[model samples]
Target: MRIVHDWLGPIELPEAPERIVSLAPNATDTLFALGLGQRLVGRSAFCYRPAGVLGLPVVSSYTRVRWELLASLRPDLVLVSTGVQRDLLQALFERGFPVYPLPLPQSPYGIMENVALLGALLGVSEAATRLAQGLAERYARLYRALPLRRVYLEFDLGGPITVGRGSYVDEALRHLGLQNIFSQHPQSYFVPQLAEVPKRGPDLFIYEPKPHRSRPREKVEQLMAERGWRLPLVVTGGDELAHYGPLFFGYLERLVEQIRGVLD
Candidate 1:
């Protein structure tokens, strides 16, 4: 029922990993997308999608994982995305745990590749491939349907952080012919200054506003409401903006319409 082979080399793993612990939200989402939600025994606190997974045993957060709790769960396979829980991963390994650390999916294809990796882990290769194909088709449609917009997308505004041109999110934006203003920012984590935002006045300031609270630019939004700044936007962030994993396609469609509203 399950196959354990690497994309390039030989790597042996169980046919169907009975107990899986996902330490990253995106990673957990990928597993769910592969239809292996039933196998998840441990999940990150940040993994909120697929609805019911919130009730799963919580072992990690964005910043840390409770190693004691994770170890007690005795998961057969541990999957983590890079950057978030490296320390916990080290502990897991030292304690003789089998863990798979996935590098950040830096590109659109890379994300799909990770999907394939997830499929293999879940022993649901066919299902995973189908999901990946759906995403590819959505991307192709978006790429052909629209023209590039002078758009600004931020992963978070608390720090005024944004994605660069070639980042995964930016690559996704490219599908809708959307260009990120931060694409102009230096590679890696680029933090934009509020002062820098107005001079060029990106056509749309698609910010990810925290649902209940205003972001770091709250005062600026107020000032702009009084019409101090020239840029206007339909933006997202916080819980709502986090529609990255499977909901990425949704984020793109909303972005396309918002950009259209600005252009029209």
Candidate 2:
């Protein structure tokens, strides 16, 4: 039986989640958040949560997990996540496989909802609730009192393109009280023409510098310096953005706090 707590919302557990296979990175992280790793039988090549599962079998990539291979694994519960092999999930169901497609949450509340749902699915609802509450408290403490500002999001180094307005990062930014500079872009992820860059005039630029490519974050930083008043939000020296691990909240808080401090 599931009971909704005053602070943690609905919490419940499954009988036993044995032989589980997670196809999404975030979902993999969520599984770890619930402390249910003993059942994880398969994961994507990108699953980096817990750091110990790096040696596990790689069933697929961003959106390509081999169904025949997956079927071979014979997972009692196969987990799918947002934006990863969405269409392939339909084909899996066509094969009479009971697949669980986790819905994408747009806010921290939604993340919590997923946590509760995961707890119920994994037979550790109570533990999931406790974990969610802790993360929620941390999120609130880090973001609630900070001064909000207009923000721009960028990932690729050479390309100053920001994410789509309806992206997970954008959701995180909104919670931090920042406006997405790409909100007006017709194509969610588009390269702003030089004309548009000056017109939009974002307060910060967030880009992933090419650290592996032997490029420094300074050249681009200097190019966009603009007297240090209207610089873009750049995140240097971090590979966490490449994967959605359990500690991703730390990454979000790290970037948000830097921006908040600068804007202060």
Candidate 3:
């Protein structure tokens, strides 16, 4: 058995885990990127990456876990995310399950650390090192080329949900030379007073609508009308903005391209 330390403390793996269960979509994507898909025996409902994971046994969700089904699968290791899955992590740990919890990365460097950490845990450190190095180089290039702009980012339906300081999205925005209007807030993600938008006066606004859900254009319009603002607005897929997997690098690239198109 190998003992490893994670966000939830140290857990002992009986062996180099062959049958893995990923409870975080970002972890699932990272596993697949490391060519460890064959080791995954179970995935959470949200871990739908790598195309064929839909056939895997669904053992977890945001708030609930199928303990009976998960135990039946006999997973050697279970990867979980912090914040959203905090309660699940506690339950799994208390139940004597081999669980590894990782917090969502908050910066470009943190993302690379996550890739390297998973690589070390799974005995693929060499490959993970190469991947992290390559992604870091890509991030540097994007940051160097990015033009600074004052921006307001919108998530959720019609409300003023925004990325605050210390969030990964905030870091991503920093890399793009875009300043989040709510960056002054100490909280990571928060709902701000509506009056703050006009007082700050951002040059641009970006809206992210949830994936696979009907576009809530009316909500956006309603927000605009209520605020009486006519700033340049852009829409992006919510999943791409929120997910922290290495695959999200592609989404970040696209986001930069879109920003260049709109601002330049």
Candidate 4:
């Protein structure tokens, strides 16, 4: 058994958890990346990634937990992410369940650290260490070769919302040598009007479509046309850019390629 600190507090876990439940998408991805998918008996509805995990039983989401369903699963280790899950974590603890709440990572290095911490809890510290190190090295190289460009990244076209500082997306953009036009915003994300976007004079426009939702390039073009902003637009892999996970390094590489192509 081992004891580690989580966002909620200190918790004890078995040397190797056999039946695990992940409430956050990123945690579920980390379990699979650490080769512990077989042990993940329950996951949230939104934890679909790395494929083959869609069949798992759904127990909870970041903001909600099905107490009865979660209890029935009898998970030895229940993973939670900080933020809206705070109440869920407390409920599980009072119910005598071993729930581990992971802190929300706002930056790239914080994400890597969370991966390593998860690995330690899962008894695969070495694998997690290697994963973090490899990604750091790749990101370092990309940073050195990254192009200089001011970019406007939109996660939701309906509101034309964008990420700012304190978001992993912001860190990723900075790491790739791209400047986020909304980085100076006080909040992590905010909406900008169509007419307001052109005033910033961004060199590129990056749009990340929502999962299972189709927002084709033509739609993006239409949006730009409506706004009268003729900047080059690139649509990134929705889940890849939205998710902060072990595969994010791969996503980062792909993002760098896309940026290079756009800037060239």
Compared with the true structure, model 4 gives a TM-score of: 0.90
Please rank every candidate by TM-score, starting with the best. Answer: 3, 4, 1, 2
What lDDT tens digits, residue by residue, belong to model 2 across residues 100-203? 76666645566677888888766788998898888788777755444555665656646665655655566666677777767655554466554555566676
Number of backbone-clashing residue pairs for each candidate, in the order shown: 6, 6, 0, 0
Better of 3 and 4 by TM-score: 3
By lDDT, who's the top model here? 3
**How far is each candidate from the true structure, as Cα RMSD in Å?**
3.8, 5.9, 2.0, 2.2
The candidate that achieves the highest TM-score relative to the unseen native structure = 3
Q: Candidate 1's error at 94, in angstroms?
A: 2.7
Q: Which stretches of model 3 miss by more than 4 angstroms? A: 2-9, 157-160, 216-222
lDDT winner, 3 or 4 = 3
State the TM-score for model 2: 0.77
Per-residue CA lDDT of candidate 3, range 1-264, in tens?
A: 556565556667755789899999988988888888889999988887769678999887765999899999988899988876888889999998888876778786787889998998888999999989988888887784566778888887445578888898888888888888788789888887877887898988888876665655566766688889888777776667778888778888988888778776
Over the stretch 17-100, how does candidate 1's per-residue lDDT look in tens digits?
A: 889888877777787777778888988877877786988988877657787998889888887766546676666656777777
**Model 4 weakest lDDT span, ten residues long:** 2-11
| Model 1 TM-score, all chains together | 0.83
TM-scores of all models?
A: 0.83, 0.77, 0.92, 0.90
Q: Candidates ranked by lDDT, best first? A: 3, 4, 1, 2
Off by over 4 Å in 2: 1-15, 144-146, 157-161, 184-195, 209-233, 236-246, 260-264
